[model samples]
Target: MELNHMTEKSLIRYDVKETTKEKVIWTLVESLYEQGYITSKDEYFETVLAREKVSATGMEAGLAIPHGKSSAVKKAGFAVARLSNPIDDWESIDPNNKVELVFLLAIPEGEAGSTHLNLLAELSTRLMDKEYYSRLMAAENSEQFIAALDQVSVKEKEDKDTYEKTILAVTACAAGIAHTYMAAEALEQAGKEKGIRVLTEKQGANGLEDEHTATMIQEADAVIFATDISPKGKERFQGLPYIQVRVAEPLGKGDELIDRVLNNPDGIVSAENDTESARGSENQPANKKTGVLAEMGQAILTGISYMIPVIVAAGLMMGIAKLGAVPFGLVNEINDISYATHDNELFVILHHLDKFGFMIFQFMYPIFAAFTAYALADRVGIVSGFIGGLFAAGIHYRFWGIEEGIPSGFFGALILGLSAGYIARFLNQKIKLNKNFQAMKPMLIIPAISVLSIFLLNFYIVDPVFGGLNVLLRNTIEASQESGEIVLSTIIAAATAFDLGGPINKAAGAIAIGLAADEIFPLTARVLAIVIPPIGLGLATVLDKYVVGRRVFDANLRVTGNTSILLGFIAISEGAIPFMLRNPIITIPINIIGAILGAVTAVLLGAVQWLPLPAFWGWPLVENIWAYLIGLLVGTLFIALANIFIRHMLIKRGRMTITS
Candidate 1:
C-alpha cells in the first residue's frame, strides 16, 4: 500500500522533454502502457483528462498527480517524470508555480479510495519538505531518484508527543490528489509551529491515510477539517468540537484556523438537526448557477444509473421469450407473444415469460423518477416521485384503459421528479420538530403533501397538455398523408419514432392502421419505424470498432446492443427504449433521422408494405423487396455509424464519458 511497495526504478524517468502539458502526461501514460499497467491508452488518457476537468491536480510546488482511475487500468501503479521544462499551463493550487514533477497514476477502478492513500501520505510528507525535494531533484539518474525515495524518515524524526496539545485533522480535495496531502502537511507544520501536535488523516484519491481510531479520537482535544469536499466518516466526530474550512485554506492560513478552533470552538454536528451542519452551511452558497445546473444533471444521471438494470433485465427477457417462440410459429409478432394458442407447453411458458418481462418493463419510468428524487431530497421524496413516474407512464388514467389515456412521458417524469424532490427537501428543512414528531415528516407529511402536489400537477397540467399534443400530432400526421409523398413519409417516420411506443408513436400507428385498412397508402415508413431504432442501436454495438476504429460501447452496453438487434428483427422497438431513456438528447434524434432516411429511401424506390407486415420474415411479401432490403441496410448502418462517430467525438473532446 505504501509508495515503496507499489513503485520501482523502472517507473522513474528523468530529463523528459516538456514541450507541452499534454506531452508530459502522454509520456507517463505511455510508460505505464509499456509496463502493462493499462489496457487501453485512449481510455486511460480520457479518464485522466476527465479528472482534470473536475479540478486541477497540480499542487503548490512543482508536483502534479494525474490520478487516473479507470476500467482500462490493469494495475495500481505510477510513472514519474521529471520534466526538463516547467509546464506553466498546468493549473496548480498556487497559480504562480509551474509543474516539473509529474506523477501519472494508473489505478484500476477497484483500487480507488483505499490503497493509494498510504503512498500519497509518504510522498506528501517528503515533498512538503524543501530540503527533501532539492535532494530528490538533485538525483543524476533514475537509480539515484529511487535511492532517494527509498531513504526516508527525515520528516518523521521528532518524538510522537513533543507538543502541548494534540488535535485530530482531516484534509480532502475535490480530486482527492495533491491538495489533500498539501493541506495535511500544512496543518501538521502549523501545529508544530504553535507547539501543538496534529495527527492528520488524508482522505486522498486512493484511500485514507494516518486514519484516526476511536481511541485516538476519544483522547483528542478537537478536530480541524480542511476539505473542499465533505470528509468521510464524519459520523465518528459527531459530538467533537470542530472547525471545517476549504482544503486550500490550510496551505497559508493553517495557524489562524488552528488558533480559532483551539481558542474559540465551532458548533457541534450531531445526528439531530442536520440542516445546520457546517458541511452544508459552509459550502452551499458558494455558487448558485453552476451548483444548481450540476446538481440537476447529476440527479438525472443518478436516476438513469439506477434505471438501466431494470430496463436491461426486462427488455432482454421479453426479446428472448419472443425469439424462442418464433421457431415454433407461436409468436404473435404484433403483440410480441401468442395469446390464444397454448398447445405446446414450451410456447405457453415463453408466453408467460414475455408477459412477465413486459410487466417488469413498465416500471422503468417510475423507478427512474423515484431514484432521481431520492438523489435530490434523500429518502423522503421517493414515494411522491414514484407516484409521479407512474403518472408519466400513463398508469394514472384509472377511469379508462391505456387506449384512452395520454401520458406526458419522460418530460413529465423529469418535471414531477424535480418538483417532488425540491418540495420534500424544503419541507424537511423548514418544518422543525421535537424528537417524537420528527418521524412523521418523512413518513406522513412530506409524502402526503408531495404526492398531492404531483397529482394536481399531472391531472391539471402535464397529462392534459400531452394529451392535447398527441391529438394535434395525430391530426398533423393524418393531414400530411394527403400532401407530397416525402412530407407524408417524413411525418410518419418522425412521429412513429419520436417517443418509441409512447402516445405520439401510438397516435401515428392509429392513422397508419386506418390507412392500411382502407388501402389508401403504402405502409413503408410505418413498418420501418417499428424496427429501425432497435436494430440500428444493436448494430452500432457490433460495428463501433469497424466505423470508429475502437470500441465505443462498454461490455455491458454491447450486450444490450446485441439483444436489441435480435428483438428488432422480430418487430419490436422496445429494445431501444433504454437507450432513449438514458441518453435522449442524442438517441431520439438519431432514431428519428435514421428511421426517416430509411423509410424515405424505400418510399422513393417504390418499396411498398401494403399489408401491415413489418417483421423480417414479411420482407419477401413487399413490392420491390430489393429496395426494401437496401432501405433497411441504409437505416441500420446510418444509426450504427452515427452513434459510434458522435460518441467517439464527444469522448475525444472530453464532453461525454462512458460509465462502467
Candidate 2:
C-alpha cells in the first residue's frame, strides 16, 4: 500500500469537538470503521482501549497516537482527529500535555505490522522538526495536514539518488517499541540520501523482523547496529565492518553515522563472537545506561519478563488443582491433596499436578536472576546468576550446616544479579587476551571468576543479612503473641505479607502455626494475610486509573494482576510476588499496612479461624465469615488506593516510567 494513500480526506477529521479522551478515540475509531478500514468498530475500539491501558500513546506537545493491532483491521490505516479543543485528561508521556491532535491507527495482525510501524516512524521523524510540527498544527484543514504528512511518506525516501552501495542496519530499544523502528527509518532515510540501499533488521519486541538474508549480507558494504539490547543472529555479522551506536543516536545523527562507516575501516566486529570494537563515540561509551536506578529497574523488569511465563503456568496449574476440591466438597489445602491420593483417582491426578506446579515455581528465582544478569553482562553472567539464585531460593544453604535455611528472597536475587552482572561485565572489559586465546574469555575465564566471586558474596554477604533478618522477625512474631490478639495479629500479618513466600513469610507461618496448634492464637490473621496482597494488588491494577486519573501498571502487569486476583482466591500470595519484586520500596510497606489492617479488623470483629485451611474453600470454616469478608474488603481498598496514589506521585516525579 502507498504511504500517502493510507490517509485521505475521508480518514481525516478537522476541528472535532470531542473534549474527552474516550470521545476523541471513539470518534476517530468510528471513522476508520465507516471507511472500510476495519471489520468491526467494537473489536477495533476494544483493542485500541486495551493498548491505551497498556500505556498511554501520548507524545510531546499536543499529539497522541492511539493504535490497535488486530485481525479486525481490514487495512493498515489511520484516522486523525485535529480536535477543536484540547483533551485535558488524556494520558501522555508529557503529563502536562493538552492533547489537540490524535492519530488513531488500525494495524493488521501480521506482516503488515512492519509497514504500519514504518508509517508511524516516518510521522515521528517529520513531527520531530519544530517547523514541521508548527506547520501541521497550523494547518487550516485536513487536506493541508494530509499534504504535509504525504510529503515525507511518499517523497522522503524515494527522493534519494539511485543506489550504488548497500548497508544493513539493526535497531532495538530496551522496551522494543517505537524507537526501534524510528531509528531504522532514520538510517534508511539517511542511506537513501547517500545513494546507498539500507535494509534494516529490527530486533525488537516482535522478535527478529525484516529479511537480512545470506545473499544480502554478502553484498552489504557495512553494518550499523543501534541497539539497547543484543541483536539476535549477530553471529551472522561476524567479520563484518560495523558501527555500534545507541538506539536513539541514528534518529538524529544518521547522516554522520553513515559517513563514519563509509569513511572509516577499523571497526571490524564479531571476530571472536564479540560485538565490541572501538565505539563510534567516546562520549557515548559502549553499554552506557541511563542511570543506576533505571538500569537496575530495567534488569529487574527483564528478569520479571522471563519469570512471567513460569508464574502464569504455575498459577494456572495450581489454581485448577485447587478447583478440583469444589466437586468433592473437601476441606483441605493444596498440600493435603497428596494425603487423599489413594482415596480417589481424581485426587491422585491433582496431587501430581499440584506438585508439578510447585516444581515449576521453584525455578522462578534462578530464571529471574539469570535473565537479569544476561541483560547486564551478556552470556558470561549466566553461571554466577544461576548460582546466586540458588542461594536466593535457599536450595543450597544446607551446605552451610543449617538444616532449615531461610530463603533470601527477591531482594537477595536483585543484589546478587546486579553483583554478578557488574562483576562479569567489569571482568570482561578488564581481562585482555590475544586473538587466539580471546575465545576462552567468554567460556573459561569470565565464568570461573564470576562463579567464585558469587560464592564468596553469597556465603559471607547475602545469606547472613537476609537470614538474620528472617530469624529476628520470627522471634518478634513469637514475642508479640503474648501481648494481645491485636498485637499478635499485626505481627503475624505483617511478617506473612512482608516477602510473600520468602524467608520472613515462612518464619511467620512457623510461629503462627505453632501458636494455632496449641490453641493460643487462632489462625485468623495468618490465613487472611496469605491472600490479602495478591487480591489487593489485583484490585489496585483495575482501580489505579480511576484513583490517580491514569494507569500505573503497564499491559503485561495488568494481565498478571488479573491472574493474581484469580490465584488469590485459592490462597496463592505468590501471584503478587512480582509486584513486591518490581517495587519493594512501595509495594512492601503497603502490603504490610494492608495485611495488618485486615488482620486486626478481622480479629476485632471476632473472625476466628482455627482450621489450617486458608483458601476460598475454607471460608465456611471461619467463626464469623461476614467479618472476614468485610476485613478483606477494607484492606484491599487501602492497598489499592495507597499504591495508586504513591505510584502516581513517583511517576509524576520521574522516579518511575511505566513501560509498554
Candidate 3:
C-alpha cells in the first residue's frame, strides 16, 4: 500500500488549540463524532483509551497516533492536530517536546479490526521522512500539507526490479517510531540522490509488518536492518547480503555503507574500508551494552501496559456489581421486604455487569501474550500471538481438568508464538512463488500456511507435553497441600519474586489455579493466595520507602500495592509485579517471607473461605475476615521489615548504592 492511496482528500484541520492531553483526545473524539466520522463519543473515547493503555499509541518525534475502533464510529476518518500544549503519559519519551501533532483515527467498530494496524505501519513508515514530516509541520495551513503528501508517490509498485538491484535502507535509533522512519527517509533520499531505484522498509517500536516480497527481494542485491530491533520476516532476505548496524551509524556514514552495498570501486564499507568499519567498531562497545537497567525499564513499563486493560475491565465490572448489591447487613431485611422480589433491578444490573467483566477477563491472557509477543516481534506478531495465547489457554484448561478449566498462562502463549513465527519465517524462506500468486501473499497465503503449521505442531508437540505437565502439576499441588499452605505459599512467593512477571511467576500461579480446581481450598482461599504477594510488597514499600527508593516509588504504586493486597485477599500473586521491579533482591525475599507468614497466619486464625476466584477485590474472600486482615497486615509488615534489613545491610557494606 502506498501513501497516496491511503491519503484521502478528506477535510483536515491544523493548528488546533488542544493544549492538554485529555482535550486533544476529547477534541478529536467529539469532532469525529459530530462530523459523522464517529457515532458516539463515549464508545470512541473508550476504544482510544483502551489502545492508549495498551502501549501509548505515541509515535516517535513528538507524534502520537491515537486511533481506535468503536461502535460509536460512523466512518473512517483522520483528524490531524498540533497540540498547543502537552500532558504527561508514560510513552512520551521527550517531555520537553510534548506532542506537536496528534493523528486521531476513528473507524467504525465493524472496520476496526487488524486492518488499521496495517494502515498504521504504512503511515509510520512514510512519516519517517524528515523532509516529509518537516513539510507537514511547517505548513501554515492544511492545503499545503496535504499537497506535499500528495506529491509523494504513495503507489506501491509490483515490478521486482523497481526495488531490487540497488539498496534502499531505513535505520532508526530505537527501532521505535521517529528514528526508524527518519532512517528510512534518509536511506530513500540517499538512494534517489545516487539514482538507485530503491524501496526501504521500516523497523519501529510497532515492529515490521509490510515488506518487499519474493520477486523484489530476490532481485535485490542486498538488504539492511538498520535498527536495534530484531528484523521480523528475516527469511525474506535469507540469501541477500544484509548489513546490520545502529541507525546512528548509517546517519553518520551512509555514503560508506551505501558504497559497499553497491560495489564501491573505491573503498567504502568494503574490504579496503575495513579500517573505517574498525574505527566504527571502536564505538561498538558503547552501543552494544544498551544496559540491563534500560531493558528492565522497558520490560516493566510493558508489563504495566499489559496489565491495565485487565484491571480496568475487572474494576469497573466489580464496581458495578458492588453498586448493584444491598449492604451485607441489610440483605436479610431486603430479602423479607415486599417489593424486594419485584424490584431486583439493581441486583440484576450488577449481575450483568459482573458477567460482562468476567467475559473481558477471559481475554486477559490472550491480550498479555499478544502484546508481549508484539513487544518482541512487532505488528506481524499480534494476531498470531493472540491466537497462540488462545491455544495455550485451551491446552491449559484441558490439562488442568478444572471444572471450568485452566486459562493458558503467558508461557503457553509464547510457545504458540514461537511455533507460528518460526514456521511463518520458514515458509517465507523456502517457498517460491511466481508473480501470479503475489497478490495472495498477505491476504491468504502467509496466514493460512502459518496457522496450519502452528495448529499441526501444537497438536503433536504441545498436546503431549501438556498431558505430562498436567499429571505432574496435579500431584504436586495435592502433595503440597497435604504438606500444607505454608509450604505452598513459600513456593509461590519465591516464584512470584523470581523474574518479576516471567515464566516462573506464571508457573506458580498456574499451580495455585490448579489447587483451586481440585477443591483443595474454597474459592476464597485461592483468592487470598493470589493477592498476597503484591500486598506484601506494597506494604514493604510503604513501610520502608528508602529500600524501594523514592525515585521509583510513586503515588500509583501505593494504589497498586493496596490493590495487590485486595487481590491477595482473593489469592492472586500477579499483583506484586510493580513492587517486585523496584528492588528485586529485597522485594522478592520480602514477598516470599510474607507469603509464608500469611499462609501460616491464615491457617492459625482458621480463616477458611474456599473459592478459587480471587475474592471480588478482597472483601469477602475470607470467612474470618478479621483474621484474614490481621494475617495480611502482619505478613505485609514482616516482609517490609525484612526488606529494610536487607537494604540496610547492603548499604552498610557498599554493595548497593542508595542513589543508583
Instruction: Note the Cα lDDT for every prediction shown.
Output: 0.76, 0.78, 0.54
Model 2 gets an lDDT of 0.78
Best by lDDT: 2
lDDT tens digits by residue: candidate 3, 384-455: 656776676564455557554333344455467555544554444345456477446444776786667666
Error of 3 at 200 (Å): 12
lDDT of 2 by residue, 99-209 (tens): 998888676655434665566545655655556678778888877887777444234435324678888998876545456666787788787767788889987646677
Rank list by TM-score: 1, 2, 3
State model 3's lDDT.
Answer: 0.54
Which segments of candidate 3 are over 4 A away from where they belong? 1-171, 175-226, 229-244, 260-307, 323-343, 372-380, 395-406, 460-467, 476-527, 537-593, 604-627, 637-660
Residue 456 error, candidate 3, Å: 3.9
Which candidate, 1 or 2, has the higher lDDT?
Answer: 2
Estimate the TM-score of every prediction.
0.82, 0.79, 0.49
Residue ranges of candidate 1 with Cα displaced over 4 Å: 1-11, 33-43, 71-74, 110-135, 152-274, 277-289, 333-343, 399-403, 538-563, 570-572, 581-583, 610-625, 650-660
- Per-residue lDDT for 521 in model 2? 84
